[model samples]
Target: MAIKAVENKFKKFFYSRLSLFLLLLAVIWLSLVLVKTFYRRHQLDNEISSLKGEIDKLEKKHQELDQLISYVGSQDFLEKEAKDKLNLKKEGENVAMINESALGREVAGEAATTTSAQNPAGSNNENKLIQWWKFFFSR
Candidate 1:
């Protein structure tokens, strides 16, 4: 009878220890799963917030482009373009165009005469390459 009671006690002790180990393992696995889920949720939230900010910027840009498009399509913009590019003018409006090349030539001739008068000896001493360079690029 003493030996039977000892065997039964051993069995009960072993089962209790096994059950405790299994419960501990299950708790650890559940904790790991919860931690991983929280990390994933945090990553997704950060991505969502960044995307929302990008969307807002894009919306603002879109609005600005729409305004620019409307302005470009207006009649005032068309008239301005015609006057500036095509030289078109309204009736009774005087349009004066300056002759730039003729004015430039007159100014350039005076400059060349003054430069030559100031340094006649220096001008003569210059090489052919220097002379050609001055002729093409002086003005």
Candidate 2:
């Protein structure tokens, strides 16, 4: 009777279907967790690669801007800008003003004619004074 009881216990310990099913479920769960971890790691690596690329592009742009700033700050560039914009010249150089005769003739034709006899000198001065007052008050 003692030998039979020991043999039945050993058989139950080794051949229980529920225990086997639980072991299999644990292995499957572990495999799923490992797969999810690996996938997330791969996604993060791709994001890092893209961020590195963006950093490289910004670095190149920064280098270009630095060069441009250096050039603009140079005396040569300043002289060119001054000559073009302000029409500056060296000492002993004569500055000539080009006449726009055609444009002046067109403007002369469009000018209003107001005679002092019709408008009166006092009225014109009064109009100017009133305009100045209105401008100052409006501002």
lDDT of 2 by residue, 5-124 (tens): 999998897689987898899999999999999999999999999999999999999999999999999999998898779999768878777568977976676563434346778988
Instruction: Tell me how many clashing residue pairs each candidate has.
Output: 0, 0
lDDT (Cα, tens digit) per residue for candidate 1, span 1-139: 9999999998887679787898799999999999999999999999999999999999999999999999999999999999999999999999888899999999999998797678767556675569799999999
Highest-scoring model, TM-score: 1
- Worst lDDT run of 10 residues, candidate 1, spans 120-129
Query: Which residue pairs in model 1 clash with each other?
Result: none
lDDT accuracy of residue 12 in candidate 2: 90
**Where does candidate 2 stray beyond 4 Å?**
1-11, 91-139
Residue 65, candidate 2: Cα error in Å is 1.1
Q: How displaced is residue 113 in candidate 1, in Å?
A: 5.5
